[model samples]
Target: MGADREGGARRRPMRAVACAAWGILLLAGCASMPDSGDLRDVESTPRQDTEVRVFAMPPRENAPPAEIVQGFLEALTSDDPQYATARQYLTPTASRRWRPESSTTVLADGWDIEVDRATAHEDSGDYAFTLTGSKVARVDEQQSYTPLDGRYSQSVHLARDKSGQWRIDTPPQGVLMGRSDFQRNYMPVNKYYFASDTAGGTGRPATAVADPVYVRQRVDAMTRVVRSVISGPTRWLDRVVRSSFPTGTALRRDVTALAPDDQNRLTVPLNEKASRVGSERCWEMAAQVLFTVQNLTPTVETVALQRADGSTLCTLGADRARTVATRGPVKRPEYLYFLDDKRRLVRILGGTAGTSVEPVPGGLGEGLQRLSSAAVAWDERTAAGVSNDRKDLYVGSLVQGGTLGNAVLRSDGKTEDDRLTAPSWDARGDLWVADRDPARPRLVVLEQGKGRPVEVTVPGLDGRVDAVRVAADGVRVALLVQHKDGTESLLVGRIERDGRSGERTAVSVLGLRPAAPDMEDVTAMSWAGDSRLVVAGREQGGVQTMRYVQVDGSTPDVPAPAALTGVKSIAASDDERLPLVAYSEADGLVRMSSVAQWQKVVKEGAAPVYPG
Candidate 1:
């Protein structure tokens, strides 16, 4: 369900005095501007770490049709909680019928409003205006954001009411605003769920997957997020993730506010539907709440689930939550691995400086099998490497005497560029690599890094897969697809495995969507967090740049990492504390330091990677 549905029925109103005070301050600021000066460009204020409350002005008495329309658009961008002021611009019936939370249409710029001449007739007491702009994205009812590239045009109708005041009669169904306003009004938060294939209470830890969604920054956010958790994962991720909350679960009807206590413990009150779950299931439910809530605020260290009758269902703390469900890789990698000057696998401690690079303890690292690129497994005990020729893939252990096995997979492409790409490991120990052979491109995975390769079916692939990086959760894969126009775009797809037992399980990548749609060429990318990626690419007609993007295709609120030139391959650990390692054409292997500056790691190296 989308936020604020049912006409913001669940939303609480902001204090009237607070809204009035903010209005006075806004007017005062506008009144204080200099009357005359040479016009200078004013830089936009940086996004605030704390919420910025905005209260839009209501329509003036006897306002004109254009003024009414303009007022409504501005009000949509305010933090008015229930958006009561925005509704004041509409007729009584329209206000009652409008569903502002149905969805949000974000345009590249604020919409252009112009009178629709054919439909605007002063004598008829009616006016029609069209809203036009370049649509950049849309947040659906489930709060799943999707990048869009197209024109947006919507018509709104207004008429004079009995009070001789202009009011909108046919307002747009959902809220609409520009990208800047959208950013100011919403913030992304991750809701946690266990992988559909894993069960929580088992001996093995259930893998937690992040399902990101946007919510109003300060509008009873904790309560809204809790409700979203009860509503379940967004539609796009529903098939691959499962929420522990029972079917029809929801917050008790009268429960509208949720806050952590002084000790940073939050108690969620659920409806009767969740009152009868088993203790194990309730703990899983609490674990889900803990993980989800912690992302909103690190201070929330524990979550206690309570039934509608005010009885505790289960209480799970952050420490215990980790054991019940793991997010991304369970362990931080001891060292970052890469191909050294000798084309052999080598390693350096993750967060230390002045550390000497040393060969890994294995045949692949013994300078015997020259490697083009490599991926260390989740446990750091095993590694997969692509031969220097890019035609063969080898897997070996990190033990001192371990020998590299014969090629487990081979590409018969005619040239190095057309052969296998670099390999990536997932949390499940499965290895993924794509063969870029033009005649027969294939995305294949090796179960446990052994046995016959299982070709992954990509249903809507329109180009050759140039690179593959499976996220540590093992449910999403990032692919660099080369199009016919010679441009490469980064796309993310969901990994779906059929419910068949044994080695013959069916696997396919579905719902492939552009993760970096604005980029004309995505040269390199890596998963930098649970649902964020560090991407190096260039926009159309723009210079190459590095930025962080969420899996849902939205840019992160934080600033981009320190800039670097000619980045060829980038690698990052889900543990963001570790430095980012990248291979640059101009600087060889380098890593970002604690100061956010890129420092040379070695005079010569390539394909730097941390354990998956």
Candidate 2:
């Protein structure tokens, strides 16, 4: 019965849990619960009653648990040194998920990791038994918080080594970058996360942990940052360029023409702004993103190219400018900081840098930010790209595997339920899809055909499967599942190539609760570089977060712990390498470890390194 019932819904929903109130008193009823501190291993567990018979507390206003987890995970590989490696965890897209300006003060001063533990309790169907973690804890007085309105509501970050064991890694090595064994995982529709709260005293009045004055001050400061970053968006578009037309060149009647003069002209600002103290020379090309996705109405953000030098090539967005998308563009970039010769940000932008996020009624910091939560992928083989000979960026939504490639953008249907998610390309160029089908959500196989779609199913995924990853070799598949109750589980299964429903051979369990918080479902996932799978979760509220989870190895420890969880929605590459989007609290994304501490912990752990 245990096997047949799939844990009998023993676990609750794996959706992202936002501990917006860190001051959660552990819920008084928790006293009757097991003592996780006892280390008695009573088997950590969350209730499974789908029915809401128990109210954990006064039901204070709070962020979902998923948000907290996602924030923490992104915080792990927080070092700029971890960027390249971490980028692999991101899907290939052209949208930003971070606010460079917000991170400038953060990443510029990166964290050193110190992991305490990275393991899941159990996996019952999609529900995970227990997934808890701890860190060395920080004492950043300026950043530290107390309680707000009798409750604890502070920006949260965790410190843990998803690497499991410790080891030294190059930028690329930080993630599963350039792994020869893995396949190139891709998703077209870029996902993003937003941290700005629309929760203006919504629902019931919630409590805060930080002193109301301090919290208000911090919020006001962030508000100023937001205002500063966005002010340039409109001004840059109007004053910077139009006012910089060369001398008297007859300005095209089509483009807004303003003659450049000492009075109103602008320069790269050869000031000490981003100049290094002692560097002899600096190369500055694409000083500004010629045009941003918001200009063209981007579904996701593919921003930034961190150079070998400490300096980074990033997109700079301004909110004051016209939000110019197809219908209406958004006016924010996830991260706001940029690196100078000294690896410091001279200017910071605002907006999400994620690849799978939906622009929720967002715009110029005010308007519905539209997102094409498609989660599709293209490679050297698909039409989504220019050619195998060219470097082209294509964005697509998830389509049923059966309808994959066959239709450039065709999904079974865009009804309330049939939306594409986690679309990936296989070696054979066929599309293997993880159907979000509520009735019978199975792995749908889609190949290029002439007239109509020929649908097939994978018997292995007969129940609630969240996300699926096909190994680089195309012989294996990793499954991220969320049982009905809200638990999480991971399983690696062998894929049979028979014409009939492929047979599945279970290898070993990777993690039971890899994507908690946003565990309701995994919206985006891919093989990052070699040894890891970049996975993203869809929160119960429809938002998702990204995760760089470890893949199985030759040993008992198959699926390892998740890097981040608990956010609205996110997307990542397989090995946790390429980052279409970095983590940001403003976007509701989580960073388990603080940038400074995560780097430190991994070093101390001298942890075992996984091979690509």
Candidate 3:
């Protein structure tokens, strides 16, 4: 090679080259290497003396306390027709919770926000403050703000982004309403507790059977609830009753008690004379505790959650359900009830049922697997209820999978009208179920339970919900709601608590462009990175994908129509991660950073479409 190099054009000798690349992460003032991507730098201890606590200042002192207080009032009232505020100061995340489909929930003017003092306790780029004010609903005490009427002092938790501007973690969770009872209140022995079943509609209603509210109350309140920690599984109930209860104003000697030892038995009986059915409680998913007997078939039972304890919590009785059912061939012996944490009954679901009933499991697959397979056959016979009283109504929950999460698909009735639309969950963890009704339309939020689902309400947008999405944190949610008179859109809101009431705030509304006419609804929405949402489902194999950043209703900054080329399933990556799109038609999964990068993945080969 040396001789050849003398005559021919010799290539330069390739040397062993070791390349080194370094990244620097800057925090405070010092720079250090971090694992990568938007994780807010985690730095090692400093070499010298500096106290972070000393520098911490409350929200009002560091910045104008007035602006912080005003911003919240403005955002809160933005939805009110009387107090329509502009959308300038909202951050992208804040705007997501501020989407309003209907009117914004407001605190009537009678409630004055006279900020007594804003003491900035601490600041680490993020801010925290303690706020006190006198908030009163209108003296008239109407439905608008009837529940909250009084003065209160509350802790205000706020956060600041890289921009150094402070914002509330959520105005809803921190706000306090004195009049409302539970959902927040709890202690050693308090009558008030969290409630669920409200105004019926959890399942079917109970017949005119005696209400168990009094009985369950006696159980939770009169019975001394001893700690299971010292003992195990609740055996302590016997000891607690023998030693602590029985004397003074405690339990009456005449009344019989549920033996602690009875818990081990498959079926334990409650004293019919002493115990009554409690109101039934429902969750957003599946849940039902049977009220067939005063005694529950040995299972761990607690009082159902309600708005507040001691307050009138309505639960459905199984027999009541048959009477209320729009269709009948009413069967009794129904079994199901929701009890409060105090072991008081909340509601009755399916009463002691006839032989036709079956136990509903928590997971989707477990439910479907339980079917005898004959339920599908149109043929009727004398076998396992397949012929006449089919199990379809009870089975098709479209439940979330056991661990990974999946949905059960079942129709309530033999006819098509009774079948539930396929249930699904979006990028944000909020549950999205297809609507069955057109006019008084309803899309139920199913909370998982051992027996039946607990239906919870999403305020602001009611019924006709085309799609709903919970944020990465199941706490925040967005919805694609359908309206009468032919209107549809993206409605974003967050769950806030005013004392006991579950309040929702509408942050923004998404308007579909006529240019993309064929797209009927925004079936899937993923908040890619910060301000952009990668909207899917416009055309068929046509796979229309668009990214939108909201500025206002008039002008949302959208990239060129072709920003995303032939996109399919899209997933927004978390901090330090690149958003991914599944173009199954081309490859399978395509990774990208921004609009430009996503365009590159599409240009190379399109991903296949996800099953609609």
- List TM-score per model, in order: 0.92, 0.28, 0.27
Residue 544 Cα positional deviation in candidate 1, in Å, after optimal superposition? 1.2
Clashes of each: 0, 181, 79
Best of the candidates, TM-score: 1
Best by lDDT: 1
| Predicted structure 3, TM vs. truth | 0.27
Question: Which regions in candidate 2 have their CA more than 4 angstroms from the true location?
Answer: 1-371, 374-378, 381-418, 449-456, 460-462, 484-488, 499-525, 535-548, 553-577, 580-585, 588-612
CA lDDT of every candidate: 0.83, 0.27, 0.29
Candidate ordering by TM-score (highest first): 1, 2, 3
Candidate 1 stretches with Cα past 4 Å from truth are 1-51, 499-503
Worst 10 residues of 3 by lDDT: 376-385
Model 1 per-residue lDDT tens digits across residues 1-612? 111111111111111122234446322221112223322322222233343466667777666666677678767877787889899999999999999889999888667665677767767898887777789999988778999888987889999888888899999869988787788778899999988888766778788999999998778888888888889998888989998898999998888799999999998999999999997788789988888888898799989998999999888888887778888788877998899888999998887886588999989899889999999999999999999999999999999999997999999999999999999998889999999988899999999998999999999888789989999899989999998777788888889998575748788999888888888678899999889999998977899999999988888888787878899999998887789889999988888888889899889899999997
CA RMSD, predictions in order: 5.9, 25.8, 24.2
State residue 160's C-alpha deviation in candidate 3, in Å. Answer: 47
Candidate structures ordered by lDDT, highest first: 1, 3, 2
